[model samples]
Target: MATFSLLVTANPHSSQGQFSAIQFAKTLISQGHILKRVFFYADGVLVASRLNCPPSDEYNLTKTWAKLAIEHDFELVACVTVAMKRGITNAAEAERNALTGDNLDPAFEISGLGQLTEAMLESDRLVTFG
Candidate 1:
């Protein structure tokens, strides 16, 4: 089976971007293909934020992606630069930066763009869902 890397760069509330990413990742897993990584960049950093509390009726894409990553063992990485700039930092980063609290989920890691580059190099296909 081929391994794929998905790069998501759109905001979490954008229906097109969020649904498309979830569908793509789920389809890849269902097809027996491995997901090497799910790299969140730009506004996509919002997906890693645990503070995101959408309405109960709305689909929480952040939780959906987090669940998928935990279940499938895919590396879910949020771009450190983008995430920090967008105020989506983990406990350690928040502490280091003197931020109030950790706003990012544990399922996703804060990493550099180098991780995305590595995913591109290691995977059979690199698909962007923004």
Candidate 2:
């Protein structure tokens, strides 16, 4: 099975890119492929925001993605630069920044762009969604 890396570059609440990426990841895994990592860039980092809440009837994109990551061992890496600029800090970052609290989902992680580069270099395929 081929190893795959995914880059999700869209805002979860503004477009369908996140949903499409989720489906693609699921399909690849179900087909017995290996998923290396899912890199969240730009506004895509919003998917790691614990503050995200859709209407009761609407899909909870953030939670869905988190659940997928938890069920599988795949990494959900959110770009720290983008997340900080957008105020999506984790517990340590929030404390350091004197923010009220952290809202980053537990299933996601904050990291640098180097992780994205690593995924590209190490994986057999790199798929982007935006």
Encode model 2's per-residue lDDT on 47-101: one tens digit a residue. Answer: 8988888899999988898888888888999999999999889999888889998
**Could you tell me the TM-score of candidate 1?**
0.96
Q: What is the C-alpha RMSD of each candidate to the true structure, in Å?
A: 0.9, 0.8
TM-score of each: 0.96, 0.97
Clash pairs (backbone) in predicted model 2:
none
Write the residue-wise lDDT of candidate 1 on 1-130 in tens digits: 9999999998887648868988999998999999989999998888898888999998888889889999999999999998999999998999999998888888899999999999999999999988
- How many clashes (backbone N, Cα, C below 3 Å) per candidate? 0, 0
The whole-model C-alpha lDDT of candidate 1 against the native structure comes to: 0.90
lDDT of each: 0.90, 0.93
Model 1, residue 18: distance off in Å is 1.9
Residue 84 deviation, candidate 1, in Å? 0.5
